[model samples]
Target: MQEFREILVAITNAHTSKAELAQAITLAADNQAELTFVSIVQPAWFENPLLSRDDFQSFWDEHLLAIAQPAMDAGITVTTRQICGHPFHEVIRLVETEGYDLVVKLAEPSGVFNRRQLTGNDLNLLRRCPCPVWMMQDKDAEQPAQAPVILVALDTSTDTPEQIALNRKLLASADHLALQEKASLHVLHVWDLYGEDRLQGPFINMSREQVNELLKETESTNRDRINTLVTTNGIGDAAQCHLVRGRASHEIQKLAASLKTDLIIMGTAGRTGLAAFVVGNTAENVFAGVDCSILAIKPDGKKHQAVSNETDANK
Candidate 1:
């Protein structure tokens, strides 16, 4: 739980939910951080005959004031800015230039099958933003009285320094969040023997016992790794750890649902060039399956170059 020094909350529209605002305000107040409320006014909106650019500006100013009043009342330093540009691009540009440590925004629904999905803007921020992105989910119903559950997904199979750092980041973020909200923290690691089917097929023709032994060995090694990660991070017994054998994406969704998780803290390994257009496959799949809020982090020095590239492309 790195303390955020400067926090930016992006209002998707006038109707941004109160829950989202409250979450951002609470984080800022708790951290004693400066909070900024921002909204984007697309140039296309000005083309309509009914409204002038000044009218749009005035409307946004009023809207931001009304929504940001709670934060102001909490005695947190606050500012409001309304920029004119593409919403996603403008938000990233501000992040790059202003050095905000965290960006909070409500997740937009993807129209397919009426499922809650991350829109292109949300994905872009998760991919390109240099800082952590907290995407809050809209909830119409009240939460349960019991403690909220926060899950941190880790990939313990890799011993790479980058992956290890990411694991620590995810755990720290999740632990801090759980403490802040009086929530329960759960850590999860999914492991499997890659190409097990191929090994048992005619190509390799390994015996059933041998395949089983390999699976057992794989699980044992993952268990050791996850346990070491938890102990070394000072999490100790405060958090419950789960090691499951299955596909990473599917297991995550299943466990989150079973635990009724409120938020998931996970890493998005940054990509460059053409690959930067999409988030990591595991993260993307989990995003599509679970409707809970997500805090996506990137490993240190892994921030995508999309900001500079986009700026140049626009120029």
Candidate 2:
């Protein structure tokens, strides 16, 4: 819906998610978009450090070509790429510089290691990458394995407008799928004041009036923004707003579980460096907290600013 004319699929030879790849292909074909298959090769220093640089490059190129073969066989307009350095960084760099409307990659599995728990490379990419990321874990499955259902998760965050806009665009895709399977479009927003108040600090006994005021004022406004967004965009009926209260990610996880959503559409500002190392982003937290499939949108920094400027001009 947002002119996804160019798509980038990040893959690896080692157990790449076929379901995600199939999904990416389906999205591209549906939109008549071109696809670029990108695979990053960690230099095989173990093979031979003394190997010629050209030889190493050739090996990398061949590996990406091999990975690209499957998509090509499916009649996808595919291009192969090989890059050095960290996998996530390379992927993000490609998405931003190449102007890809969407990025499709495998979802990293959980129950693995400690470092990955807080912020793995992929999760970090989801936060900072300037495009949307679709993480797939199962390659053998189709993306819309059973008629695609679009679920958009909303919250009291600064990026909610972009998230809502993205959801509307994805709904267009769902509309396309509606012809095949009954596609349900849902917008979910969660609130957890008790849980969040605990994070605010140790119990400083607050009055019922105070609590009510906060919920009524701030929380109510947050819900209002969500309502305004959906209404303005005509994304769904007002009933589609599934509002709840709890721990942010936990609430979303519960709702996603209850809804059995096929895809969770959300946005993140992939943060890194000392600030992130100290306090991680919610997008990364959501990744660790949920089992449902996700499509993560990252800020391009200027995307919002540019949109605001155009809005002012039109006004």
Residue clash pairs of candidate 1: 1-172
Best by TM-score: 1
**Model 1: per-residue Cα lDDT over 97-155, one tens digit each:** 89999999887656768556667766777777788988877665476788999999999
RMSD of 1: 2.4
Candidate 1's C-alpha runs over 4 A off are 278-280, 308-315
lDDT of 2 at 257: 74
Report the lDDT of model 1 for residue 130.
Answer: 85
For lDDT, the strongest prediction is 1
Backbone clashes in model 2, listed as residue pairs: 17-139, 18-139, 19-138, 19-139, 127-269, 127-270, 128-270, 191-245, 191-246, 192-246
Clashes of 1: 1
lDDT per residue (tens digit) for residues 27-75 in model 2? 7777778888877645454257688787877776777677767767878
Query: 182, model 2: CA deviation in Å?
Result: 5.9
Worst 10 residues of 1 by lDDT: 306-315
